[model samples]
Target: MTQYTQKVNETTLKMPVALLQVGMFVCRLDRPWLGTPFLMQGFLIDNRETLQSVRALCSHVFVDPNKSLIQLRSPRERRRSRRETPEPPTLSPTVDRDMARLGLREVLPTYTRTLKGVKQALREVGRGHPLNPERLAGQVDECINALIDNIPAMTWLSRVKSHDDYTYEHAMHVSLLCMVFGIHCGWPRHEVRQAGLAGLLFDLGKLRIPKALLGKPTPLAETEWQLFREHPKWTRYLLEKSGFEQDVVMACYYHHERPDGRGYPVRKLGTQVPLAARLIHILDAFDAMISYRPYAQQRTVYEAIRVLYHGRNSQFDAALVDQFIELMGVYPMGTLVELSSGEVAVVIGQNHDARLLPKVAIIRDRNKNPVAEHVVNLKQLRDAEGKARFRVKSMLLDGSYGVYMQEYTRHLVLDASPA
Candidate 1:
């Protein structure tokens, strides 16, 4: 409504953050796009929160006058000139209920296809075939779509399944987490696709490294370590040659670099590392910690979460780490947990508001015997006193009390009905 005039000769105009309005289009910021929470290359200022977010991160931004809904005019004249834009429709309760009832089997096909595509691409890279950018992009897009359809189902499957080969499994895991993180942060679709691609390609260079060195049980000597560190550089070269975009290349190349500048390769400090790279770094580390690598012992979900929480700001971006923890919940999916009632359960979904309370599938009864699987929404259940009916007494290891995720994952596949 504030009347302001600026030269319209240029396509982009740099204006102070104070002049930014809700309807403006922010084409570029004063700082790098990846350094801030705004992951999209460009975005429309849709609401007051978005406007404030931009203002908080930047002093000035490059705006495109053509993209904005309003032009220079007095408040009264502007109100009369422009038609009010309708707000986007919110999901109706019926739609929400349907999505809630959507079976995990409904999403598994897409998830499997995406994972298979990732494995095939990584295998091609291992065999010295030239990377296909178009194919990789398509794979990433499918992955993004699957996550959009049902994030909890995809996430649960990703955590439950593991490949015989670590390289292939790790690539898919990191890529899935990257896509999930992007969506959780409310990034635009383009940025989410880019993040997914970066995750898939981030560790392709490891294929070029010798298997002996990678699978070595003991600590690597300095020479081996130095050679191991060249994976990022190799990734950059491979992507550059494959004609991938510079942003994706940079993300894969610098994922090992850390916020505190203590990370490997170039040792980029703080925002010097791109947001996608910083995001991939967290996922890569978390996956690695919980995974069964030859050199390291597999850690429980709670242990991995602790490592990420403690390393915040020093080894990783503090805010991103917090968000990652929040996304995964205190008891992440696929985790084996013992409830207060002496039953064992596997975490299936997160309750965002209640970090400790999560939706789970009870697999074992109080006597540690196998039982019929039933989902318990911990957030919904309450005792007469209104306290949580069944609290997670303790986190269990992968194969606790004769119950294993691998077995229940099979059960889930066969009985694919909605819980």
Candidate 2:
């Protein structure tokens, strides 16, 4: 009898084309088999024609030893084989707190650029032209890169939104937050970009909604309400017609769906919902809550966050709700807060390591009078006695204590909104 290498349990081996034999059972082709004319689950290379067909399409193939009718290697070669060591995957740890904050600040100019481009794209699309997919893609790349570098500056800029620019800024804010949220969820770079693009376009259908309906102070009538409910499907159709990818299309379509199956259109429930859609839904609601819309009084950042927490299981995904709360924090940026020092300040940024002790810009003094506004990073402040100074007393609602928000944030680094 012909000598054969001792067989063990089923094992896969990468074999060169020259070594293939009639009894070898092919497992996988190096290239896509569907692209080739040959169609089979896998073939037993029992003849020269079969071997020739495979070699024509692939430089090498995977073979199963157990499936092969004949043994592949001699006993000496089998005994000599040793397992190859696979290199461990390289992991990158997120930057330290201070560095990350600095990184966020450094990307503001990039954000300004992307924001300008996005606003223009939206305008064109609202005018009935399809958004240039390439342009939107470039902005998404810039956004993802900025968020990956450091979250502070972008986080800070997101809060600098002006009520006057609410229409233009809402999309930009959602897009930025989506990238940040995606990174928090440990998504890969490309996936983060996908989230960003989806977010920027999630409200595209609303652009087509008559401004009169959107701006009505009273509740929307049933006809107007029906139009609002239909926006998600409209957005999905527009995106599909515009050649948007499946991820973006589905995210836009299902974003308004509720976790409790009460949401508009599809009414998808829980994990059945697309992750992108769920994330955009949470962020969309958050932005709308905090925005100074013509119809609704702007809710304080604290108040909006409270609402999100309250609706977690029914209106939003519970895990994502927790993650977002931790990400945005109870005292997130733009929150107008009073310090134990009797100072009134607007939250400017967060100290990642010390979330409760965020950086704030002192807009008013203990007497509630406007002062020479300056930033006080809570983590760095200390009393004359060398003890940490300044804890948040309570977050005041927007407009409760009035001051010019634009002027306070208008540092040398900030100028007019990008053209």
Candidate 3:
């Protein structure tokens, strides 16, 4: 191959603003550059604001570089440039609507406790202890049951993140995402649990990699990259050693594989990838994109969904991506947003019966004042004339307009309590 072609393949990819890190050269935006903060055509990302500024502008951008100093890697793109329209943020008419949204309050306990169990098991695996595959399976069961009962709570918990516990928490979140997806697709309980187990075990192989490489704050060297992809074999060995089902082991082995055969390890294309692996791959990418990692920036829920949408067919299963968009809707729960009414809010819950009009905590007034927060369910909300109560003007940066979901949720509970 010519050097230029190699450089282009090695360099440019469509990346969400959240994953962009300091020192990477951002060569393009999702929109025009005329109104942006940058003066030059391409500039090094210097600080946190660079990402906040970029996210405020567009969902994705062209990041052109052979490498990065932050050791950050680009998410695989489904299309090559020329942004396509995002799928209309709508729900599938065929879905059960209340697939996992049933009996939420009663099932909340099972969902909350399973995360702690999974975290402890993963920590043991990191220390080279044997994985209790059965224990993991049980947690997967709990996870699936929890989602099967109360999707909004499980989904909301998934969005609550911690930078220090990223690996463990990511595994837990991905597991929840997979279970939710399975339930959404009308999969049987056994199938849903299997998918959840696979998500929990997706990164078992990475535990074998050296901490220096895994924890590197800067862009990794070519050698480190080589070392990174070899963890699949290690993961397989660990899973087998721990007596996980063969299907579960294979899922972890191929979660990084893509539909076009462009992914790592086996590089199997299309249906050659296991179905469990395919489901895990999409949610894994979704969680990684939305969550903060020391190595990469975090994208908004919209940006992450859009990247996944554009990647369909070429980089991911087109049908699965569509289902994911349909599932998460235009705004997933916990998303901080600016409404057309000029109110600042955080999505707190989702309507299960129909549509993706999520419930939001209105934290700031249209005039941008800190308001006494109250919840609004978008689906039922109607103006005097009876239109959709409000629309999201644009997805906002998480902490912008002084709205943080965790803090807002805490106060919400307290304020609702009787004196």
Candidate 4:
């Protein structure tokens, strides 16, 4: 029999790769961490793909039992667990039935309407007209209400829609993400709406920047960069002059501020920054990275999430970054992914507690050809052999294998009407 090392007296235990589970915390790899694709030095095996990767990478690893979500068990129990196939976590019946009641089709109109409001607000700022607070408040209220009723539908719309005009589109995306995150944090409805408004108006200052500078594909000169940093101040000035609430104005002003004091326009660090400002900061950075910008190419959702994780406690608020990751989950809405069965699908709904088992809309078959759209709930799916039927193999970029979210909007019952 092969000798297996299990140091019960130490904080870290040596475990064979075959004994690893989804909730296990892998603290050290047998090989150099840099050689592998993991973003964090130590992380939990949150999903099947990560578990498989670790099995393929090393024969054994060091796991921190205290950091793991699962309990350390006897070798007999561990062997039994390895022999039984693990199933995705299941959601409560009431919650499952409630989620099924709402769909993207029911929420698309509200999303489109809120997007128009975002565009109109930018137009007001550009024309030097005062932003109509009443109009803005109405739109924000409607959007928040829609999100409160159905988070997945709103998130799907935000991820799928990308306008040629990046300004308002980016604003809309940030605002929706902020509201969703606020709800996840259990904030009151009024507070969630405030965060959404602040995010929607965070970048009005950029409208005051020069068009040449905004569109410049090359690096900005020092003088130009200095001028660009002044936009946050301009944003504050514009919002205050329009008689907006002080909280909204301040959030917009400090949205660029970083926890490490490296951010522009005042460099407020730590607890000195308001909670709303900190929340907007993470969402703003994330949407910008994933959006098509003048100087930067669009990144995949997973790529952007990795950047956020690496930047925690430095570029963004640490707790808020963790909360955002939990809110978005491993496969966020609208993520294009390839299944182990070779078909391609888009994540459409989250199973709440079961973050790894999101409901996906299958759009392409094994041959990578377009097919009639169908929804698959990964949590409940099982094959004739009673094993898990589908598992996500890997997440793909926006246009991988000719799968683009924009091209499938019609099938999603969105972008079919004039915006």
True-structure RMSD, every candidate: 14.2, 18.4, 19.7, 9.8
Q: Which prediction has the highest lDDT against the true structure? A: 4
lDDT of each: 0.79, 0.75, 0.73, 0.81
Return whichever of 2 and 4 wins on TM-score. Answer: 4
lDDT: the better of candidates 2 and 4: 4
**Candidate 4 residue-pair clash tally:** 0
Candidate 2 lDDT over 1-419, as tens digits, reads 11132233347776756457788998777788777866886778898788777766766777887789997764456546633434332211122333434444478678878878878877888888887777888878977777777675677667765768786688888888989988888898888888899888888887778888878899988988998888887788778878988998898889988889999797778888899889999988888887778788787778888899899899888888889888887687667899998899877667654577887777789999888756677866655533458899988766657754444445424432333
Ranking by lDDT: 4, 1, 2, 3
Q: RMSD to the native, candidate 2?
A: 18.4
Q: Is candidate 1 or candidate 3 better by TM-score?
A: 1
TM-score of decoy 4: 0.73
Tens digit of per-residue lDDT, candidate 1, span 1-419? 11232333466766667568889888888888777888889999999889888867876787887898767344344456555754333213334324433546677677677778877877777777878899889878887888897787777766754436577777778888998989999999989999999988898788778999999999999999999999999999988988999999999999998888989798889998999999999999988887777689888888988999999989989999999988887887778999999999887767654668887777799998988667777866765544567799989866679766666666666654645
Q: Report the poorest 10 consecutive residues by lDDT, candidate 1.
A: 88-97
lDDT for model 2: 0.75
Residue 404 of candidate 3: its Cα lDDT? 61
lDDT tens digits by residue: candidate 3, 1-419: 11011123556766655445667778777777787778887777777667667756766677776544555333323233214645333333112123222333345467557767877876887788888877777778867766765777678767767556788788888888888888989998877877888888888888789988997989989999999999988989988999988888899999889988899897899888888898788999988988777787788888888899889977888888898888877778767888889998777666543245666767789999998656666765655533566777778765677666556544444443446
Model 4 poorest 10 in a row by lDDT: 91-100
Prediction-by-prediction clash tally? 0, 2, 10, 0
Which candidate do you rate higher for lDDT, 1 or 2?
A: 1
lDDT of 3: 0.73
